[model samples]
Target: MTLDEQLKQLAIEAQCHLAKTPERQRSLSRLISIICQSNKLVRPFQGQFQGVYEEIYAEAQQRLFLYLCKEIDRYNPELEVMQWANFLMKKRFFIEASRDLLPTIPKGVDRSRIKRSPLEVLEKQTPIASQVNASLTEEIIQCIQEDHDRLFQTTHIEHKPAANFQYIALQFLAGYSWKEISEELDVKVVTLSSFYGRCLTKFAPKFKAYLSQ
Candidate 1:
């Protein structure tokens, strides 16, 4: 199958898989194995694999899964479930896995010998704290509003559950590394990295997209 066809199938499979299963052990296993195999291929072909694949993979596996799980557990979840599932599928299959096929270079040019300019290299690097802080602030504010709405509609609620992303984002923005966030959040470093990565992907794009509108 073509890559696009494969991705379409993958997204459908992912949705069906999530709908049938509440426990994610099987999903995690399949996704992690796919990721490890892709990482093996990608690391050796670093120049060819565009930089965003790793980030995209983390979102598919972690944040999207968490969001879906939350929806499944909710009492009345039709809207949230559909929205999150569609968003997750689009992000994984279309935005993440889908790519234009590059034509092979003609016999004369040495494609492997090409190098990035300084500006290109700089552009490839992530600007960590400032960007993370801005995104976290926005999500935190939204989460707080969500809490307010829930509390206003309900009675005798003690406190709203804090968003995992809000806590982690603020920790990283306050000069803590993934290790520190993991320690505070009581998760493994790998899990923390995965969560932070997924949140950042959704946060950055949504924030930028909103600004452009």
Candidate 2:
């Protein structure tokens, strides 16, 4: 069977288990495990939170499991299970990250004496190290956004190549996979991967400088 057929089958089975009471817990847990195993959902969080990646990954997985159980009834069998699972995983990561960054007051301390996470403190300082890290993130984001915009605009380039660049930006900067872009654009996976590699090669120098900023 094709990948699409397999995903649809998994979705159907998951929906069936979700609707039934006796096998619900076991089946849902199995389905969640399968989804987690099939996708590298934590890759996007690694570069941004390198020091705390393990914590973030554990939190994201736990939250995703809970969320899938809570929203199982709303699962759409027509959609790919892994895709939806990855989407929820990314959402959970951001939610957990934000929660972690929130200032908290100690039991006996005043609200003004709230403690901040290391990330928050780092962002607030004006040291050279902090400035370089902040500048790198800002510049990379700006450069990617500019490239994304240019790809979408009318330019003196072939339509296919322009579209390929836009898809590459979406994959790298937007955390999409080649498979997802292929499905969306109705292009073959091999073609998209090849073009994406070319795009990366072309942008390697600029990206290197941004990372070193």
lDDT tens digits by residue: candidate 2, 1-213: 654456556546655753333245334544554555456454444454444445445544544554565567677876766667777666444444334433342233234323456874553342321121201233554666677556433321245554556445444344343344556766654455445444544555566655556
Candidates in order have lDDT scores of 0.39, 0.48
For model 2, the superposed segments whose C-alpha errors exceed 4 Å read 1-7, 17-20, 101-213
Question: How many residue pairs clash per model?
Answer: 0, 0
lDDT of 1: 0.39
Q: How close is every model to the real structure, measured as TM-score?
A: 0.29, 0.40
Model 1 scores a TM of: 0.29
Best by TM-score: 2
Give the true-structure RMSD of model 1.
15.6
